[model samples]
Target chain A: MTADMTTDMIADPSGTRSPGEVLSWSRATLEPALRGAVDTLPGSLRHLVGYHFGWWDERGGPTGSAAGSGKAIRPALVFLASRAVGGDPLAAMPAAVAVELVHNFSLVHDDVMDGDHTRRHRRTVWSVFGVGPAILAGDALVTLAMDVLDGHPATSVLAAAVQDLLSGQSADLEFEDRNDVVLPECVRMAQQKTGALLGCSCAIGASFAGAEPVRVEHLRGFGEQLGLAFQVVDDLLGIWGDPAVTGKPVFSDLENRKKSLPVVAALTSGTPAGELLAERYATADEDLPGLAALIDEAGGRAWAHQQADALVEAALCDLRLADPAPGPAAELTGIADLVTHRDS
Target chain B: MTADMTTDMIADPSGTRSPGEVLSWSRATLEPALRGAVDTLPGSLRHLVGYHFGWWDERGGPTGSAAGSGKAIRPALVFLASRAVGGDPLAAMPAAVAVELVHNFSLVHDDVMDGDHTRRHRRTVWSVFGVGPAILAGDALVTLAMDVLDGHPATSVLAAAVQDLLSGQSADLEFEDRNDVVLPECVRMAQQKTGALLGCSCAIGASFAGAEPVRVEHLRGFGEQLGLAFQVVDDLLGIWGDPAVTGKPVFSDLENRKKSLPVVAALTSGTPAGELLAERYATADEDLPGLAALIDEAGGRAWAHQQADALVEAALCDLRLADPAPGPAAELTGIADLVTHRDS
Candidate 1:
């Protein structure tokens, strides 16, 4: 993750970087521009946004540590996708910042909706600032994302992805109240919720690189598949990962009765264990570990892992189809592996 | 308000149209375009937005009436501003729709933040559809507003206004917990929250018409002053207007202990009534009528009316500075009168 490693990996055509190194480089390239854009926000919103980004404590002092700042995965994808299309990564800096801002905006609002209190090992924006200010902070971030684009041709691309993201979130909320959500619709919801923005990140990066539409579409396909894989891995982590590592309570998703992909698959499996799991889920039962066992017995765990592997493979296929530069393609592959394999 | 009257009024250079006629014409011209843009929203969000606009009932059926739809005042400003700049109002249709969408987006989110249950005689979007969906619907709308601009040169103008609007809202929420709020900052908040978008609507409309920057700035000045006047009138209405016409509970602002312009003015007036009002306001006393009387006794109401008159005069002076065409200028003046004088 050192500067020398980044330089060496990027300069050598045959060298590949780890996902951590790629993210480190991306964050280094992105943070200044990101902060500059955020600084343009009005003072009140600027303070809340900085707090949410883990750049400062709640009272606007420097946090003195980068403890809760996210992994910068989306911005990394944007920069790498630009480089894959043979563009200087700096040319796509605005796109990268916009994507990151949108991601954080969704995180802030989603925390309020989901009623979660923690993320990335820190108290969430709503938990600390109150819901009204949190909502305004989210609004300011999304607005700033568009303003940073400054009438670029990619504005429509970003807007469409935002629409899809909102629709996906709408569907996800609706699913919470309904007992009859099917597997296909749940999958579609996940794609809309998570895949759209990731796909947009790649497509926008390529477009910023002046890539042909075909290449941009392929890059988008690559990101969409990877995003689905990431979600699958995330769902698995939500259920089984160590609470300390994940920065969330153990079985928090189950406690909320979130219809994660694995849970939905288990509910619709038509196995005896699936029926038992459903009966337990309908009641106020608190046996989260037992429910996890039933989902495993219903083959949900295996199905999710298989989906992740297949999605990642498909994402790699799209990466190849985009005819990316070999070095960036290798780094993207590394990132995909990390996304599907990481514990948190 | 009739087709023949509208045609006759527009055709006759010497004849002037009423504000109601101007608004009717604006609504007629704006509705289809606004609906078309909203229809592009994903179905889930579209449903909620339509409900918010009073286009349909919660079940998605026609309301069988247009009883609760807003007056479309912002869209009227956009159109009139363009026409005043000697451009065909039709050319500014997208800007009109965009301004209207931003206005509604703010309204939906503001209702959630303000915790109001009703708007325009119906349950608010959040109250009817749940807060999460309401927030999503607002997000969809602002995104769509930017998308409607579609790389237009005016996108930055709209974006800046959105930022100001959000900042003003943030300050407003902050002020709710403080007792030492001053008159000047309260006025600045109103200018940011209400004046900015109105100014933006005028500026964007004129820009769409290819008006020079000077004219655009003048038009913006006109709108900003008018907006401040409108806010003062609205604050007055919030305290004293009939519930049937204003579509809100009587003395609602006092009930919420809202630090509205007139209330703040009275609170800082250094009168005995002001001191007594402050003491009563800090209590759980439910005497809203008594509170209203204290505000009036403290000179809040008369001061507000004087301010409104001065602001409208200032707005008209700016309109004259823009060198607007005579016919549209008359209509704009009419609309300004309506805004300052209306009961609702």
Candidate 2:
């Protein structure tokens, strides 16, 4: 494990550990737990799931098998929430598995719908296997995830989680068509697209702990706020983070013409940046580069960063309301801050 | 509704009801159930689902009413099986809704994959709404079905049902690429594609009734057998049924060069009839008329009819093992006979 993967930090700004240390530790603990679940899929489907999980090469062979797997941040948050409520993180394992699977399933399908050839520096599932097989694989994984929830969690909790995932996905799809999405709408979209799953994850963990309904609600709120903050940070990174650190090409969102939180915030600015970005989105694909420059000149980047900062502050407020016990909660809050504040 | 929609005995002799009647009843029950659930979707997604469900016209406006909704036979089986097993069918309503939604979700995606333009004499969801929106609608419905399952059934039962749906879908997709599918393999594929969901429906009903595991297994077996019989009848209709009765043009299997049961059986035939049929299957798309004649000469229709008859007998044998007490069980038996023996 990396030396960076075993440190702790307090929630307060005055906390001592570096952000990288907390992030690394969260990654260290979450990867194996999520990977173990992925490895447990039936033989017929395991190879496809593994390919999506970044553990297998195209021909059902093993990839390098190193642990640059997905960030695992979502699963970490789930486990952390469970522990914060004095529940065993192990008890929340199935939920962690479910949420991660749903996330990956969406990724596989979204890549197809967007016609994105590459994901995580490898050929997307649809690109390598053809659209039909890729679609089947994604559908299978999603079904399997719901099935896993059958094992230990309460049916109500699992149902709620699945509902949240669907609602979020529905909102995300809706956002694609609108020409004028505002900050509040984007925030709501982020909640549905990102917050719903996170909230469900936390709620599931609390259920396993046998926490009271009020407590579960509190944890859900904390998760929702955290997710919103995470998405806002993601939007900022889409526009401004260095390619090497973010592992995405420069101007990637601009090229896709994604109306992310920052772009939406800038559009709310009702200034040149918002107008330029909207004009670029309406323009033909061939003219994107010049339009992207106009957007940058209009302060889209700075406005997006400001939005991220505000969301992170709001998330901290929700975390305070949860009033979790000191150790795990502090560590989780620190990690949330790291996620909301980081460049990558 | 047309008189044809109410009753047409010779056209559906083995079936308990005519296609028009069966289709209409299914529409009546499922439309209200589905509308209740879809009402929860956001404006954009709600509209998309509405259009796909045949509640809207080509221009995205409401059609003033729903028409041509799919036959909700799967949901009926779930409810019928529940009642047959002495369970309160009302308790299984959520699951009944779930199975039907999943079935429709598959139908939407399958139509796209198969490049089918019309279903029930109406343009397909993809044909009207564009592929992107249709895909989102399918994904939304699938997730919603999973959510619906969360409400009423036990977690384990719902999970298992979801897994069965996915497994069945996987096998069906696998069948598309397989040209060497034999009779037993076809039976197995049918079991996976159709039998599994039927089995789940039965098992879920048993769960509601607090039935013994052994009894549940028997009911599941009955459902599985019935499902296979149902598919075999469908295969027969694909090749030789009357257009007015089936709603599809005759000899569609020949036009699509589909590997239906009769085609598989004839391929096994070493007689002149078999040779002629094989030659027809090998012919180009432009040779459909001659191919249909060749298939008829090969006794493919008779062979398929015989196979379907045998499957129906087997299904009845399995049902007897369940020993379902009078009313609902008898009605279910009657329905099975209709599915297997119906002309359309």
Over B1-344, each residue of candidate 1 has an lDDT whose tens digit, in order, gives 45665543553335567888888878877888999999999999999999998899999999987777799888889988888888878889899999999999999999999999989999999998899999999999998999899889899899999999999999889888889999999999999999999989889989988999999999999999999999999999999889998898899888888999999999999999999999998898999999999999999999999999999999999999999988889998998999999784
Candidate lDDT scores, in order, read 0.91, 0.67
Report the lDDT tens digits of candidate 2 across residue range B1-344.
Answer: 34444322322223344344544554555556678887766566677777777787766677775555656777666666666677766667677777777777777776666667776667787787666566666776776677676545344554555555555555555655565567676666667667777777777767666777777787788777777777777877777677666666677766666666667677656668777666556657466666656666677667767776776677677667777756556666767777876783
Which candidate ranks first by TM-score, i.e. highest?
Answer: 1
> Candidate 1 — which residues are off by over 4 angstroms?
A1-14, B4-15
TM-score of 2: 0.86
| Candidate 1 lDDT over residue span A230-310, tens digit each | 888888888997888888889988888888899999999999999999899888899999999999999888899999999
Instruction: Spell out the clash pairs found in candidate 1.
Output: none
Q: State how far residue A334 of model 1 sits from its true place (Å).
A: 0.7
True contacts kept of each: 0.77, 0.25
Error of 1 at A82 (Å): 1.1
Q: Counting only residues 3 or more apart in sequence or on different chains, how many pairs clash (N, Cα, C under 3 Å) in candidate 2?
A: 3
